[model samples]
Target: MARAQRPGSPPPGGLSVQDQAPGDRRRDSWKDSWGPARARLTDLAEDYARLLASQDPAAAEATGLPSRTLLPDVGPEALAERNRVERRLHQLVRAVETPRSLTGNHGAKDDDARDSTPGDGDPWGRAPLAVRVLRAHLLERLGTSIDLIESADQGAELNILTSPFQGVRRRLITLPTDLPGSTSSVQDWADLVDRYRAAPRALTGIRDSLAVSAAQGVLPPRGQVEAVARQTDDLARILASQARGDLSGGGHAAPGGALGRDLQVAANDAAQAVSDLGRYLRGELAPLTPVREGVGPSRHACWVRRMLGTSIDTAEVYQWARQELVDVVAAQDALAAEVLGTGSRAGDLDAHLRADPSTGMSPEDFPRWAQGVADEAWDAVVGRLLDVPDGLGRPTVLLDTPGGGVHYEEPEPSRSLSGRVLRSFAVGDETVWPWAERTTVLHESVPGHHTHSGAQSLDPSLTLWQRYLGKVPGCNEGWALYAERLAIETGLLSKPADRFGWLAARRWRIVRVLVDLGVHSWLPVPAEIAALPGAGGGTQWDRPTVEAALRAHTVLGEGFLQFEVDKQLGWPAQGLAYMLGERVWLAGRERAQHRAEEVRKKLDLRAFHNRGIGLGSVGLDLLIRELG
Candidate 1:
C-alpha cells in the first residue's frame, strides 16, 4: 500500500503543480484518491458562499439568491450572525488550504483510507477541473474578506449617512419594476415606507456604534463626515421636493387608490426619517469627527489587504504613485498639445471643448446617452481587439443617488444574463467632457467591466463561489482601467475629444494614487506635485489643498473634484484601486509580452486577456505565477 503525495507539495525542485503536465500521475497510490479531496473542498466552498449570501438580503439579491425580505434587517442580532458566519467560514477555508501532515494510502487493502463521499453526485464530469485550483485561489480571497468583515466598514454599522444605508433608499427606487399603477409598485412603496420607519432604530444602532468607535479614536475624517451629512441632506431634499410624487421619481398629484393612500403615508414617514437621519449626522456626529485625514499605517495595511487581497508597503506604493503621476501628466500634456495646441493646457482645452452644447454630453442626460457609448465601444473592441465568446448584453444602466459611486454590478447568472453598471450623475449642473465620458463608459461597461466581469460570470468553467466571491478589486478594476487605455491603443479614440478623454482619465487616476497615498501614508508632498495641481504648493494634504491640485493637473470639473476629494477621504485606499490595480495589470501584461518577445512568438493579446479573465479574480501574484 504505497502512500499518496500530499496535494500542493512541490516536485524535486520548487516547481508548482501548474508547471506539471495534467497527465503526470507519477505519485503514490493515495494520489488516485486525491480526486475526492478536490471534490469535497470545492463542494463545500460553493455551499458556504450561498450560505453567506443568505444572511444578508442585499447580498442575496445582488448574487441572485432567495432574499427573505425586500429590505435587510440591519440590527445588532444580524451583525452578530454575520460575524459568526464569517469566523466559521474562515476556519473552514483554512482547513482546506493547510497542507495535510501525512499522506494516506488508497490500496485495495486500505479501504479504510476512504474518509467519506463528498456528495451524492459525482460533479467530476460536470464541474471543471480548474475549480480545484480556483478553490485554493478563493482561500486567500475569503481570508481577506473575513478580515474585512471584522474591520474595514465597521464604521457602516454605526453611521447611517454611509453609502450602504443610503443604498437601502436607492435600491428601493430600482427594485419595483412594474409601473406606479401596478399592485407590485404599490407593495414596493409600502415596503419602502416600512424600511423608512425602521430607519430611525437602524440609524440609532449605527449612532451608538459611532459613539463606541469615537471612544476608540476610530472617528472618520472631517471631510467624510461632511460628505455623508451633505448627501443625507440631498436625500431629504429630493424626497421633500418630490413630496407629491411616487417612489419612482414621478408625480402622483391626486394620491388615492387601494394601497396608494397607505403608500403615501409610508412615503411620508420614510422621507421624514431620512431627513431626521441627515439632521442627526450633521448635528450629533460632526463635533466628534476628527480633522485628521490619515488612518495611520496599521489600519492602512488592513484596508489595502482587504481591498486588494494582498499586503504591500504603503511607503513603496506612495513612492511609485508619485513617480507615475509625473509620467502620466507629461503624457497628458503631449496629448493636450496634439488635441488642443502645444500652448493649450488641459483646463483651457476642457473649457473650450465643453463651451458648445454639441461638444459634450450634459451630465443630466448622461443616463440616456451612455447606452449608445457602451454599445458602440463594445462593437469596436470585440473580435476587432478582444474576444467575447458568449456575445454582449447591454448593462442595466441606473442613475446613482447621493453617495453611490460609479460601479458595475455582475448580474447573478441564474436570474438574467445581463449585468449592470451604476453611473452616478452625482455631478449637478456639470458637463461630462466628451472623451472622459466615453472612457468611463468603457471602464464601467462594454470593453471594461461588462467585458471583464461579465465574461467571468458567463464562463461555464467557473464555479458559483468563483463568480460570487473571487473578485479582487485590483484584478477587476485594474482590467477596467486598462480597458480605458485599450480604447486609445486600438485607434478607437478616433475623435480628438476621445484622445483627450484617455489622457484626462489617466491623469485623474494617477492623481488618485497620489492623493490616496498622500492621505493614507502621510507621504511628503513634493514641489512638482504642488505645481501639478496648479493650486499653489501646500504641505498639508487637506480637502482644500487636494482639490486645488486636482484642478491644476486634471481636466475633471469642480463638482467631480469635490466628489473625488470627499470619496478619497471617506474611503481611503479604495480610490487608489483604479490606478494601482492597473499598475499590477500592466506589470503582468508586460511580463507576458516581454516573454513572448524573448521566444520570438507573436503574443496574441486577446489570448492573454482571456487567460486572466478566465481565472475569475484570482490574486495578482497567483495570476502572475500561472501566467508565467
Candidate 2:
C-alpha cells in the first residue's frame, strides 16, 4: 500500500494546500466560506442520511451508519412514510439559497455550463460548484425515490439482486461481525440472535407487500420471481447448514455454547421463514406474475435516470451499443488471430483461453494470486497514472460469498478498515481463471473502484452524506470501466491472453447495453446481431435469445450467464450503467484535454483524475459541468 512520492510535490498522505487547484483551494475553506447555506445543506444531508438508513438497513450497514433496525421495513406504512420524508427533504433542499459571493460566476459567458444547471433564476443554479453538486444530487436522488414509490416499482421490487429478500439475508449473514462499531462482544452476539429472531416478521412484511402489489396489478416478472425463489431456497439451505454448525468455519461462536445454541435456534426459524417465502413465491406469486421480463419504457426510463443520473435516448444508445459491440468483437478476433495462430469467434477464443492450463489456478491459491495482481497494479499506477493519497492504501483481496460476483467494497466510514476486492466463485468450483481476471483486478482494485471509492472515503472536503450515500452507479461503474480501458491503453495487460480477456470483458459490457435496452425498452435486435451464429430464430429479445447472444459474445459460464440475464431483467437500466458511465468519463476527459490545449497549457492526466475522483459520486451532467 506504500505510495512513491512525486518530485517537488507534497508527501503522499494528501495534497498540500498550495498544490491544489484554485477551486479545490476554495473547497478547503468550504466550512468558513459558505457559512449559513453550507450549514443548512449539511443539516439537510444528515437528515436524509438518517432517513435512508432507516429505510434500507443493508445500505446503512454498508456505509457504516448506526441503525436500530436490523432489517428494512417494507410494509405499506413504511413505504408511505419513506415517500413523505423524501418529498419533504426535496422541498427543503429546493428552498435553500446559496450566497452569490461564493458562486464563482465571474460573469463568464459559458452557455454550456449555465445550461446544465436548473435555470438562470433558480438559486441553486447560481450556487458554488460544491453546493450545486450537493443540490443536484439530492434533487435527483429524492426525485427518483418519490417516482419509484408513486409508480409502485418500489413496492413490487423482487429482483435476483438488491431486493429486500437478498438484503435481509446478506445483512444477517454478515451480522455484527463485519459491520462498523462491532466489537464481537457478548452483546454483539446477542444482537445477532435478536436479528435472526426478527427475520420472520421482516420477511412476512416483504411477502405482504408483494401480495398487495400483486392485488393492485403491479407484479414483478415471473422470471424474476422464479429466480428469487431459487435464490431463497439456496439461502434457506445456507442458513440451515449454519444452524447445524456445518458452514460456520469458526466464524461464529462455539456451537456448543449457549449463545451459539440461541443463534442456531434463531437461524433455523429464519430458515423456515425463508423456505416459506420461497414456497409462496413459487406457488402463489409466480402464477400471477407476467411472463414478459421487461418493465416497459416508462419504468425503464425512470431507472435510467435513477441509475445513470442522466437521460438517454434508448433507440439511439441501443444502436450505438450495437456498433460498439461489433468493434469490440472485431478487436477480439484480431487478438485471437495473433495469439492463437488463427482468427476465431469471441466464444471460440474464450473457450481456448479457459482450456489453457497456464490460465487456471486452484481455488485455494486464487485469493493470494489476485492479491499479487492487485498489489502489482497498485505499484504500477500510483503517482504515475493517478495521484493516490497515501491514506488510501491498497485494498485487501478476498473470496466473497458464492454468487455475489466480483465487486469492490469501500472501506468503512470510520477509516479503520481498508477497501476489499471480493472475488466470488461458485460453490465447489475448483479452477479459477486468472488470465481473464488481470484486467478485472485492475478494474476492482487499483485505479478502479477501490481507488475511486477510497479517495472519496479519505476526502475531508466531502460531507458524510456525500461520502457514504451520494453514489451514482453510472459515474462509479463508468469510472471503473474507464480504469479497465486505461490499463489496456497503458499496456498493463501485457500478455496477449490478458489483452484478449480485457477485450472479451469489454465486449460483454457492450452486450449488456444492447440487451438491457432491447429487453427493458422493447427495442428490436439489429439485423446483423440476429444474423450472428447461435443467435437463435428471434427478431425480438427474450431471455433465451439474450442468453444465446451473451454466450456467443462472451466467456461467462452458463450459471453466471443465467444469473447476469436474470439480474439485467430484474434490475432494469442497471446493466447499461458501466458502459454509459464510461462514455461520459472518456468524453469528459477529452473535453478537458481540448480545453487545456485551447488555453495553451498541457493537461495533466494525474491531476484530472484526482479532481474527478475527488468529486465523490455525482451525476454525469454534474461531472461534466464540474470537470469542464
lDDT for residue 118 in candidate 2, whole number 0-100: 43
Lowest-sum lDDT 10-residue window in model 2: 1-10
Residues 217-333, model 1: lDDT tens digits = 666666666667766676666555434554443443323575556545555665676677667677877787667776656666667876676677777877777787667666666
lDDT of 1: 0.63
Worst 10 residues of 1 by lDDT: 108-117
The TM-score obtained by model 1 is: 0.77
lDDT of each: 0.63, 0.78
TM-score of each: 0.77, 0.86
- What are the per-model C-alpha RMSD values against the true structure? 8.3, 5.2
Model 2 off-target regions past 4 Å?
Answer: 1-33, 100-126, 173-185, 236-272, 340-356, 401-404, 413-415, 427-433, 529-536
**Local error of candidate 1 at residue 353 (angstroms):** 4.5
Model 1: lDDT of residue 518: 78
Clashing pairs in 2: none
Q: Which candidate number would show the highest TM-score if scored against the true structure?
A: 2
